[model samples]
Target: MDTSRARRGSDFARLSRRVAEAGLLERRPGYYAIRIGLVGALFAGSWAVFAAVGDSWWQLPVAVLLAVAFAQVTLLAHDLAHGQICRSRRTARTAGLLVGNLAVGLSYGWWMDKHTRHHANPNHEEHDPDVAPDILLWSRGQAETARGLPRLIGRHQAWLFFPLLTLEGVNLKVSSFRALRRPSLKNRAAEALLLVGHVVAYLGALFAVLPPAKALAVLVVHQACYGVYLGCTFAPNHKGMPVLTAQDELDFLRRQVLTSRNVSGGRLLDVALGGLNHQIEHHLFPGMPSVNLRRAKPIVRDYCRSLGVDYVECGLLASWGQALRHLHDVGQPLRAARRA
Candidate 1:
């Protein structure tokens, strides 16, 4: 390890000790109960509205509400994957299957495999799938060597970012299906079955209740809102933060903290993002409950400051601006290459 890595390891050890001493690692069952309760209520309410709307124009607004509810439930699924809610690994996997595969049509097995790697090596170009090369160029190296459609998209990615987010729901569903085809996924059969059931129940109900045109419109609205809401919540977490390469030797604390950007806001923002506004703390302690992240934030921030590590936290709007600026900056070289 490098000198910085060594220092970070030492700092993390101290921080861990302080956190333990302060009892910050203890589970809060009541908080989680309240959160799960509210999420369940929202999902129920949204579905009830959808069922009541039938073929009326009110279906569009109901679809939007349902999309928001789905996004919120997804956050709970994220927590399940981290074992924050269900401490038992077996129980957590069960919860993940129910929430991710059954409820949201995402494969829990695939998500666990990808998310575990991300937690272990966040922002790493070679290891973290979140930052892996795609149609959008998020790094200078990726932009400089882009070709064909990717090159064209990279040139105008900043402008296209939000528009493209509208398709993220479809992208995620496709990714889940693709993941099921991989031989390495252990629970492939179960996951595939649950996803099929979810599709049948979800679309079957829509088509059964409404005309084909109305059903299509509701699908579009729901997916668009779901994608955009999820994208908005995730974009600020790491988009403008530091990117790690395969060669970096940073310790766990440094790796996660340096690559994560926290959004600053009060309880409203906290609830909106499912406590992900405390990105740095969440990354560092992935198993910690979402409700506890706020309390841990000041402790983690102060510890990092004392160690001279950069801990980025900014207002929500500023964080979004930073992400857009970074995307624009990365696209500049691609645009110049196209011009040439």
Candidate 2:
């Protein structure tokens, strides 16, 4: 047993006990049952209506609605991936594969690996894949070395954020297929098959029902909206929170709290964001059911205050503003160099 690991997670362990005592960590079977049924019904219902509406421009609006359904199903898959609703690892993996790959055309294995790293190190520049300076620079160090398209885009990334998100849906699918090349991916063959199956079924339906041109247009709209809606759901989580480096040594509790921020909103925003507005709690307790995060917020906040740690939470728009400001500021150096 690694005593060092135990020591590092001690604070988190105590906090976990408190949360457990409050029953926050317990799975909400009733909540998840209804939630899953409703999302599944909505997903099936949307597709049925799309088929019923057949061969018309009116289907464009239906495409948008289906995008919402897609995002929601993806969110549910996220919950399953975290074992939020599943008790056994086997069950979680099976469910994740079905929900993510078969239904949504996303690779469960690929997303699981990426998301695990993120939860393990939320804003760490080196360890967290989420902050790894892909197209947009997350830190000045990355920005300095960025070139070509990334450099061009990083300079105005804040303004381009939403527009860029329109491409993320395509990017995600492409990335999933690409991840299959890696030997580290588990059950790669199954993941690949399910994803390909999703493509065949999805495209087949589009072309079968509508004219070729209209089919292409509807496909574009669905994917674009899916990307935008998915991006919008996640953008506010930790974009402006503190970025950590190797030197910033901290225990699990502080690590999770300091690097995360919460968005305060009404029930509508809460559901839309899929309980991600309570990102702080979600990070600290990854397996905690989404519905319980809100209830755990105050408890965690007061605990943080006692420990002299800052708990960040703000209104929805403010959170986005802070994130955009960070993106703009990171690009300031490049803009300055451009001017000179």
Candidate 3:
């Protein structure tokens, strides 16, 4: 191995030992129970309001609340995928299916496949699907090579990023159904059935009590809110961080830490993000419970500093600014090309 890789391995070993000795890996059942209870109550209560209000103008706010509830559930599904919520993989998979497919109209299987790859090779130009070189180019090279409508979007992606997020909820639902059509996905029949049931129930409930126009309006509001909420939570995690080339080889610790950006805030931000604000720590330990990530942050930060590794953390607003700046910077070549 190269000297850098060897050194990183030693540092990672030391950090892992320190974290384990501190008992940071121990599961927090009580914390998860409280989270589950509160999130479940919020989801149920929101739906209750939607049902009770029926066709009133009050339904608009209720729709936004329902979107929040759905976003929270999706975060729980993320935890389940990491095996943080349950010891047994089977149980965790079951929970993931319920939250992702039945509750949130997403496919746990598709997410696991995509998210696993991202965790394994985050920010890799060739390997990470999250930063795939298409309309939203993460690298200047991609922006320069852009053509047609993708080129137009690339020229102004920074400005369009947040507005486009409002449609991400629909994109996710569409992507889930599209994934089910693949021949390679396991348990395809079961996943398809669950998704169909979710759509039927979700739309059925909306149309059952309200007039057609009211139902349409509520659907639009709920989906838009859900999409933007999810996008905001995830965008900060890696958007402003480094992008790796396919040829680059870093040790696990360096690979994860260098490409992840943490947002600094209090408990409210933590809850809203589902503990993702500690992105550096979470990337270093994907299987660790979300509740434990905050506790683990200081340890990981100090360890990275000791090794001279850059550990990126900033306020939420600053992080978003950095992300937008990065997007704009990458798009500059495309903008110039268009102007020329």
Quote each prediction's TM-score.
0.96, 0.96, 0.97
lDDT of each residue in 1-340, candidate 3, tens digit only = 5795676678878998998898888888898999999999999999998888877878889999999999999999999998888899988888888888999999999999999999999999888999986558888867767777667888889999998898999999999999988998877887898999999999999999788988899999999999999999999899968899967878889999999999999999999999999999888888888988999999999989988899999999999999999999999988777678
Candidate-wise lDDT, in order: 0.88, 0.91, 0.90
Misplaced by over 4 Å in model 3 are 1-4
Predicted candidate 2 versus true structure: per-residue lDDT over 1-340, tens digit per residue = 9897676568677778899999998899999999999999999999999999999999899999999999999999999999999799999998998999988889999999999999999999999998988799888877898898889999999999989988888898999999999999999998999999999999999999999999989988999999999887788888988989999988889899998989998878878988999999999988999999999998899988987789998898898899999999999889988999
Better of 1 and 2 by lDDT: 2
Show model 1 residue runs off by greater than 4 Å.
1-7
State the TM-score for model 3.
Answer: 0.97
Clashing pairs in 3: none
**Who wins the lDDT comparison?**
2
RMSD of each: 1.6, 2.4, 1.2
Tens digits of per-residue lDDT, candidate 1, 194-279, equal: 98998999999889989999999999999999999999999899997778886777877889899999999999999889999999
TM-score, ranked from best to worst: 3, 1, 2
